[model samples]
Target: MALSPPLRQHPSGALARRSLLVGTAAWCMGAIAGCTSGAKPPSPVGSSSFTGSRTTAVAASSSPGPELPTAVRWRPGPGEIQPAAKLAAVQLVEALGTWPNGQSGVRAAAGRAAALGIPSALAAQLAGQAGSLLPPADAAVIRVIDAQYGGILSDTASVLVVCDQPTLTGRTVRPGGTTVDVRLSRTSSGWGVTALHPAAPGPARPLDEAAREVFAQSRIELPPASAADIRSGAVHDSVLHAMLQLAGSYRLSVSVVRSGHPLDVFGTDRPSDHPLGRAFDVWRIDGHPVVDPATSRTLITEFMRAAAGAGSYNVGGPVQLTGGATANQFFSDDTHHDHVHIGFTA
Candidate 1:
């Protein structure tokens, strides 16, 4: 099958060979096109930014030689659709009614809370954990609808929830919350909740937390490299600094996990950076801070370029941002969609 424009090539060097593996032709791209959501969508090239994942390593000799550009095809996920405002409004009302504090706030707050659904649950959890002296969230406001997916059989919703707490301390508490995507299914009694597993709540650690997780995995201490040594100083402080900065810019959190067959995204071989304590991955977007569009690309592009530039060090990628031969072969290597692999050699 033909590919979209050829995958961009990293500059010339040992890293260049690594780039070939990053976007190889082995991807059953036709099979997973339907899985677009969050940051991994088939966006139009140019005038838009792209998000992606790591793939299995492809041997340099086995890559299929040049093929023509084929029309890009993306499959629809189960029951995914844009809900009408009325349906959205009704769903919001039903969601709000499902919560425990619906009766404590003004009708407006209740309405807002209902509209956000599971995100409300996350907010409530954060406030309780924070030990807010204020009356628990009486309601939630859909401050932003970060992401939503109408799945093939069930739909999922992702958003940021804002809530109000009435307190005697005369102070307000803000608990950033992320929703674990409620699955919507068609029921005889109309659309009802079929699944809400993997519910994300507040207390989702900050970028600093993600850094600590990465550092914790380190059994031996290597001389600490400044952010510049890691990515030419484009990123500084620690992995936490990179993650927090990335989260703030990307409007998401950087998840760091050492194990769990279900969540191992970088694949079977431990990524180079994971062990050396120089690499990390960005998996989910809940409770993660949002970055403005301008700064959004700052950290991401910097890393991509840095990785491409420091090709001698790590073994992972989507490979190539400009400068030609672009491919997305890394998806085939493992469960890497929605994340990037950054390995450190120091």
Candidate 2:
């Protein structure tokens, strides 16, 4: 397929080959494709980013690859904040979006959600907005790419549900996806979904020179919605520039960019860099999920540092390191254990 943007050059002493495998499940979207990316010329890639039991690693020339599930149901690799809170968000997204044959419509979707113990009113509101079909899809699966913490606090939290939707209509399947900002509150029982904000990117616009380069770079694997954000040309140049520069070295699987993120820092009134298009989240560095205990500490640490070199003012991930122009320039917590956050001041 001929697309905008240009290929990228590999950086000196780049890390080992890495790959990103999409989860199995469908949502409502346009192109149904599994995301496959690699550096120039096919070579040995890293393990599967799937957190499930069966993981199939993929290695091919830098081109779009087939969609494969890391697992049937999504699960956090390791330490995460209020795993139940994130789980509630994921379950709700799946419930409202995914349905078996013969079970279709808002009422049916609401019933599915209510079964998960979601409040009736909340379930109805979410199901109402979940979307509907005319003849209805033979079936739709919710393929959750990655669910990372948007913010975490004592009483409230935000989860960024990044995923793709592959819908089966008749014999043909369509591919598409959207990111959702799921809000939750801490209750006596456990974390529960208080609200859901699916991404509305408006419309696509021509990409800027930098974004075009980014889109063309195979090393930088962007999920559907994130790719759309960049294609819409809303992302800041510094973000795109940093991504292009980073792509030269490490293959990055970006999870979130501007949309489907919290407006303010979780648990605080401070503004979040994401909504401003000055920040992005990386769930996998060089193919190994940051949340995975088996991923190398040295690899993640170096990547975080390199992000700083690429002009990120703030970098957060599972590892904490010292030394920067400002305090807290590099931070770590449960919210970031699952991915690396790279933020630019401009």
Candidate 3:
């Protein structure tokens, strides 16, 4: 039997379904560094002992807030300019967290957001989008994990906001989040976000040259949208690198990367993770079709476990594996019978 197309689900609840689509539908309309230090040497000028790095800290003080992942780079200043700009960007993101209680609430929030540097019209549109996405009964909270300046020119700047949201799904709660790119321009008042867009995944742990070579040589073919997403660097680095690593040994065939609307699980409203750019589907491994009876289940099992080892929180395929990050991490579903789905967290 020919397998059905795999589906993706958004986890932000209803808001996720709508917002993610708004983000993509919006699309339908259409870097890095690091350092090392044998710090036995004075921890480098303004550097704090907490982060244990020479890179200048971006927070207001050395007090340390949330720890940033190794892949994220934070360069606070040559002066107060970058830090100030960063503050403006973050404020707009925070303001966007307000869940409108009703149409009136949306208008109020949009009006307030205008002060943060977003244009009134655009702010209202966003407010309307958010209002539609969120349920009236439950409010959403956004925690800014970290923010970094992507570029800073004389009059404009770009920032990437990494955040987490504790969302209510009926009575049960789950973790959900997304990264956003906010662009700001200098106005009479300071920096303000003029445009907001979903950010592509930044480097988590970059694939080594050898692994990247494997990615280039592998016969894996991704659909146009998925291919564009990968080229755009939207897929998590670890996930891409891990998949490529598998390609080095196996004749891997990929069916989907990121494109199209999210798929609701067969019997649930919860969205799959693919549209988030954190998931991929593999139809064949080592030249053996997953659905072929002659193929050893052992290969599929090993691949699933390897996915977990590669930092995936979810792996679904025709075979069930013994150990995974979560009890239901490995799933068997008719839609996935011919492919293995590997998903990662932000």
Q: Write down the RMSD of all candidates, one decimal each.
A: 20.3, 11.7, 18.7
Tens-digit lDDT track of model 3 for 1-346: 1112222222211111112111211111110011111222222111221232224222211223221112112223222335656656555554554331222256655664554445567677655544222324233334444443333457655454544543443344444444454555665555555555543333344455533653577455443334445655556676677777666556675545554323433234455566566777675577555644566889988887777777777777777676665676677654455467787777
List the candidates' TM-scores in order. Answer: 0.30, 0.77, 0.39
lDDT by residue (tens digit), candidate 1, 1-346:
1111111111111101111112213232321122111233222111022222112111121123221111122111211233321133223322332222233333433333323432444324322222211224532211112222211222222211111111111123232222222333343333333222222222323344444543443321111111112222222234444444443333333332111011111112222233234454442233211122223434444544443343323323222345422353122111232234443334
Candidate 1 vs candidate 3, lDDT winner: 3
* Residue-by-residue lDDT tens digits, candidate 2, 1-346: 0010011111111111111012223321211122222432121121225444132232312333322221134555454546667766776776566654456578887776566655667667666665421126655555677888787778677777887766655555576677887766665656666666676655789877898898789999887778888877778999999999988899998988987777767655567787778888898888788777778999999999999889887888888888966776788876788888889885
Best of the two (1, 2) by lDDT: 2
Cα deviation at 58, candidate 1, in Å, is 52
Clashes of each: 29, 12, 6
How close to the true structure is residue 204 of candidate 2, measured as C-alpha lDDT? 86
Candidate 1 wrongly placed segments (more than 4 Å): 1-135, 148-173, 185-193, 198-329, 332-346
Please report, as a residue range, the 10-residue window in candidate 2 with the lowest summed lDDT.
1-10
Cα lDDT, all candidates: 0.27, 0.65, 0.48
